[model samples]
Target: MRIKDAGDMTSKAQETTAAVSRQRHRGQPYVGQPMERLEDAAILTGRGRYGDDLGVKPGTLHAAIVRSPHAHAELGRIDATAALDAPGVHAVLTGADLVAWSRPFVVAVKAPMEQWALAMDRVRYVGEPVAVVVAESRALAEDALDLVRVTYRVLPPVVSIESALDEDAAILHPGVGANVVSDRRFRYGEPEAAFAAAPHRVTLTAHYPRNTCTPIECGVVIAEFLPGDEGYDVTSNFMGPFSLHAVMAMALKVPANRLRHKAPRDSGGSFGVKQAVFPYAVLMCLASRKAGAPVKWVEDRLEHLSAATSATARLSTLEAAVNAEGRILALSYDQIEDCGGYLRAPEPATFYRMHGCLTGAYDIPNLLVRNRVVMTNKTPTGLVRGFGGPQVYFALERLVQRIATQLGLDPLDVYRRNFVAADAFPYRAAAGALLDSGNYQLALTRALEDGGYDELKRRRDAARAEGRLYGIGFAAIVEPSVSNMGYITTAMPAEARKKAGPKNGAIASATVSVDLLGGVVVTIASTPAGQGHMTVCAQVVADVLGVNPADVVVNVEFDTHKDAWSVAAGNYSSRFAGAVAGTVHLAALRVRDKLARIAASQFGCTPAEVEFADGRIARHGAPEFALPFARVASNAPHWSPQQLPAGEEPGLRETVFWSPPNLEAPDENDRINTSAAYGFAFDMCGVEIDRATGRVRIDRYVT
Candidate 1:
């Protein structure tokens, strides 16, 4: 690996299966077709269910959050009597009201920052929810909220990244000095010497702006109360069952198992933005409790932009230590992240939980990473797609390319020298995470060919000579999915994590049912807003069971009952389809064993003698010995009583709550809590930078 940088991402570059391997389907047509989404038909026909689409209950109320207009301010009196009398006004609720009836909901995160579901006394940021109005309709909610008045005394605001980090910066929190929320520093090797001895080094300040996962169907949830009971049920377009359930349990002050979260189809798309949903969902649910009806909270475009979390806006100070060979000797970078209002949004874990992903795909020896989450008045930053990996990769790879150009080596050659070689399967990364397994060279080679990197370089040089400002950039990122949430617990203050809830039990679950009528249904607890869980699962199931993918059906709806899961890192890192496919295939294998036994009993042959042939069972040279599956299934119970395999049971079925041990950690197979397994990393984006304007445009991007 070139310059030893721990946890630094670099690019000069560029599913499923279970019981069935690729070697089994060389000549099959159904093996590789891109799957048509199961819900698209219903969605296109306007028949699919969404959170808001779930008909609101009678006397159901709608809400409009009256957000703080100032960034920081003194607590003041709120006048809502006028709002109470407004058209269709049902109720106007405040943070004080919540504090009086119910204590502030403070979900612990790894960060030291404190949070109340709503501001308890002072305002923190613009658009921070302070008071809420519940009314007859959404329009009425807005109208009634207008009549609610709050008087505040403004304080100096910390709004920029640099200002937030200053020693004398206004403390966002009274006791916590300055605006800094979290500060972490780590080192693996002697980076100073490496940088000094290196024949060449490159230092640059790079900035990655704020962007977020904007799912088409914005986040919307309608929480309904089962009449005459304190129990509440949630229906909406949400991300995963795990984290959402945990967050809700914390907010509602109920047992984790009591909150019933139901999702319908894909949630437009959440990426990392949906992690913020749970806190607010709890707020909406509590609002429903006051109104004595279901309450609907829908995020509009403006609301999403101003209120939803964004990626950590980072100003990275990057320095690379490189030999003439372009071998990385050490890498060190200091980064300042704009965490916005509170680090506790996702909590202490949100800022540094992705420390592993920030390291790209390279084998570096000594690495150093430093980051300080600075609290600003801007919207608090949370996870976005690629999470923090994209930011680190962009800075690292771009810097590496600059060093290669100075050393007169091909960027590709420089990149290859630092890559975790193909022979290095299950390589232990410099930053301490072990890669599951992958052929980096193969993927890079494929991407190079497919991307025309060689040809493009020549064209780029020519284009530059012709005064066309063309620049090509590449970043290879190594992202570990199923990031052990427990890591979040360990990194934070001991009490913070212990209070944050249980160590992540990263497990995912699926329920598969094959009725005698030839319908195959797979129920998954992880909801994929866009990633093709259905296609991937069908592909795996078809191969393992010798059935066409079209014959298999996947039911991905929003409900806590159909599928049970514990870890809720909502679908991002492109893990939804892959994780579900592997797990469901394992379940299918368990069911297939049951099928084989049923077949063995009916055909009067051992389970091993039966082989799946064209979706049916057949013995060598005995075509008449082949028994129809439905026929075999029908005779299993009846024949068992007559003669059969004596004690064997009939009707094939098996259910497994596969909670692999490494369920809370990286998908380290032997580890006790590993859940979703992701094994590869690749990212390339072409950028056009204007030095004069200090602006950059992504001309092309591939992930």
Candidate 2:
């Protein structure tokens, strides 16, 4: 909960390699400072341009996608003749049309139920888009959708995990022969011995249902194409290159490069469902191209729930192997990943990503993750707040408590015993993910101490004596990020996936420029759906440059053509606070070097001799012999060698693209990224369950 003097590296070397730090006071004005958002002025003054805010309006028409009500079905004739002739209705198209134009492109993806931009022959999931209708107005688009009717030979939808694998079950796809849509099995360590030899082993099965992102703005995209030199320029809130791009490009039948996805300065929020909106933009752009007008489709509440992706509904079984000392030994798991219908998004990436981090922060030495990405009649499951971390964490963390109870050890003791030692650098998860960095046991100890675990348990036991039912739950999770990946809805062959790319994810680009007036502006590629990238990015610059936070400006909008950015992998995983800060900081350092060079030329001193503080540059001592940063900028430009020092460039600024290395091979035994930074938090959740009715209520929760 707090960090203090993380290993005590003094002023001579301020970087502390402390395993766990509570130095809230020390890492300030940068990492732990209480700073306001840089975009606050514009956002508060109603100048922030969200998805629907930035656009060109010129008889912009609306479009609606007609979806199949059945989970699996044989398609018949799609009668859009009436809808096409209806007043204000422009056109209607289907999966066949998309396929005919070579519009639907399914990249090398999870095989079983390969994705389709539009349902081609059979519908695999509920709300699978089968056709589209474009109309003159938003109201007209809704009314016109009812006119396009497609009859179906509906089969009973595959609904449950137990029923999905039966040989006699209705085949969702005759070509695939099964509801399974994953790649292959990936195994690492030995599991049978741990399963049989452990002093205590227990397996628990639990079902976690689908949960959607609660983004304030539902998915909306308005697209237009340019036929001349500029190409297709789509301006909307659709961002990221997930399976949606492959699906929409195929559905729209356009080159990926031709479809330029321009997200607004602000997206409402991104829990990951927004990735699906990109393909929709491509489809809308194709429709706009066909109709010779801008096509806009603003998803209403029902459409969002019925159409967009949600976190996968899963039926998971967790097994725990505990030693005599409460240390975890070996574990086995069988999870039914309900990856919905398609394999576009982070289908394989999600499962594989977590498959490696599934064991949380514990030191479990052996694990087997058996996954079956099943097809269900629901919206496709995509990334939520913690991605796949929460489900497995809830299942395993809860089971650890019960395992502790069965073994007659403190639940927290079991947790502490199983944690990777503070010195266990580059630890590995049994499944296959590689952990980069962490001081696990230290973080665990700090959390237990900070939460006052002993004191709280004493109070809880006394409360029980008073006939009050109170129990505390502790959940520990390690989430993987900066991964170059796609969704592994289930375990699959590494070679089959096309998107779980960059073996070690990437960085963002930022541009810092000093105006003639001396004020600073930094343009970053990371757009905030609300994780506060802009505010924090500027802090990295201000801290590095020794300037007031106000004097430093951070912008989220940057030209992909001019600005150096590598199509930043989405802003989920709470990655901004750590990764983004470091990225923009590197950019600031580049600019700082330039500023130092300019100062050295002007003040008859080397860059190292000139230390900038409080936005002013002075040659070490002689504080009075200084110049405001603005004055240096005001005098730099135009033919003026006589007015300035000889042999100096024009401006005092710079920009650079940042990319961090990702070379740690994960321990496939416990799903740990033996390489990334790790921190700890204390969690307490109180649940009141009715003995007679089984009604559950979370009385209180804090993390």
Best by TM-score: 2
Q: For model 1, how does the per-residue alpha-carbon lDDT over 534-646 read when each residue is reduced to its tens digit? A: 66777777776666665678777756655656565356545555555567878778766666766676667788877554566565456777865444544554444353366
In model 2, what lDDT does residue 635 have? Answer: 58
lDDT of 1: 0.67
What RMSD, rounded to one decimal, does every model reach?
A: 9.0, 7.9
Query: What is the C-alpha local distance difference test score of each model?
Result: 0.67, 0.65
Give the candidate number with the greatest lDDT: 1
